[model samples]
Target: MTAADDSPVHQGRRAALVRQLRARGIANEAVLTALGLVPRHLFFDSGLLPQAYQDKAFPIGAGQTISQPYTVAYQSALLAPQPGDRVLEIGTGSGYQACVLVALGAEVHTIELEPSLSARAGRLLARLGASATLYVGDGSVGLPTVAPFSGILVTAGARRVPPALLRQLAVGGRLVVPVGPADGIQRMLRIERESATAFRQETFADFRFVPLRGAEAVAPAPSQSGAETIRSAES
Candidate 1:
């Protein structure tokens, strides 16, 4: 469906999903609430809707998958989003995560390395009535013009947290990423920028994701933002 059903049945499913996240150690009320409100089924094809609220990842094309619901809630809780935070998300994916960020009251700036996905996500977010600036480029390099963001979230697995993303964080800001070998499982990392040149990192649960790609991954910058290159399907 072009929009979430948002009917009683769908809303009940979302509520149950929130309960699942809570039992699984997602303690942030705001994160849980956001996850509960965004209808994950709307991010999937009609055939995949049956699996949308089950807390599992599902492919969304472009060789990418929308992250599992638990993973989304975990990352959102770890990011410790505050209202009005200027958050930079390194991978837009299906825009599900960005929608969560929006629901939590963050001012989001998201970048996707894949043009098609970026455009699709932008339109999806718009249709969901969420506001987030969407960019298509080297997510590994981050959005420099929006440097010093209050928080950052990276959805893909990286060999190492990109230095550029770390540099973009405001002092006292946090950057959550998944880091490890491309063919192996990745550790979810929370890095807090304590000062101009100092940061602290902590490792959380292991997860798997598509390998992040682009200039920081040894590729060139995308020539155009997906916004400039693709006509959003919903539009």
Candidate 2:
């Protein structure tokens, strides 16, 4: 089905999913509204249409899965994008998350490591008129040419926070990523760039995501700077 095929059943399902997200502690009304507007079923294959709004991750080919709705809502809530905010999404799987970001009125630049996924997502986003710029590249390094984003979100699990991404954040920008061993549960972290050389980090609930692919996936040397402060928070 195409993005234009949003019938009553699909609308009902989407609304239900939004309600579920709110009940699960996604307090960002704008994020929830964006989720309510985007048609999730259109991002799925015809065979998986029935499971589209179930708040579960399903394979989207290329060894990736469109993240579960709750995960998307949670991460988006943490990012707290304001209209016109420039945001970079590290993974473009299914382009669903990008669509959600666009619905929130953010300027989204999403990168995917897999060419096939990028192409498919590009076509779908274009058809939906989501207006997100899709790039096929090593997302771990981020899009340096478009540095200084108001927000950067990494959809995959990495060994540690990528320093390159931190460098790309605009002062006061936030980067939300899941960090831990690739094979185990990852702790969701929100790192905020406090100034030119200072950052503050806060940890959230644990989630399991596909391992991030690219050169920086191997654990990188820890940041040598002492200006960064880390704070842990339980969900």
Candidate 3:
């Protein structure tokens, strides 16, 4: 991390980011407060620490990019996890979003497509004193073993809501995701399970995200370090 990571300047930067999010219509007080407390700079490589709090996504490795602060806050606010709610997060990425969920009192179970990124994100979370179960696999399938999630958030853009994710959500649960063509901006969707066979979907904003890779997709080349994972896709 950079020298500013421990300096008051970084803290001030985080505060400023929170204010920016608020100005951009992020009104969830709990989400904003939790975001304010999480040190985003610590999640960055030392070289990129300076841009960590800039509300922009940065490449984390393995063709994946960390979701921007606004995107993270927007999705989390839509999911609206209650304290102690069990949340399943698809695409752990840099694990920044998982940390946010943990801070907001969710029992987070996050999955990543790349093993290296998964390992690296786990260590980062531990360093931040955040707790979340981490898994490396095809997140498109969701975690059936931990099914019935009270909240679900997908960090990548999908062609459509994966059937597995919809099936995993508990009745009355809410899922926030970005869905559209892989090469274009996606429509942010909030799907709420209203009953055993019914769901309600609300479309919000447009966002661009890395494609949500699955079991059928070819694996990315192995990386020596997750922090240095290659960006092969348009994130």
Reference-based TM-score of each model: 0.90, 0.94, 0.89
Q: By summed lDDT, which 10 consecutive residues of candidate 1 come out lowest?
A: 226-235
Clashing pairs in 3: 61-229, 62-229
Q: TM-score of predicted model 2?
A: 0.94
- Regions more than 4 Å wrong, model 1: 1-4, 218-235
lDDT (C-alpha) at residue 233 in model 2: 40
Q: lDDT tens digits, residues 146-171, model 2?
A: 98899999999999888889999999
Clashes of 3: 2
Between candidates 1 and 2, the lDDT winner: 2
Q: What is the lDDT of residue 105 in candidate 2?
A: 98
Model 3 agreement with the true structure over 32-117: per-residue lDDT tens digits: 99999888887889899779988898998889998889999999999999989999999998889999999999999999978998
Clashes of each: 0, 0, 2
Better candidate by TM-score, 2 or 3: 2
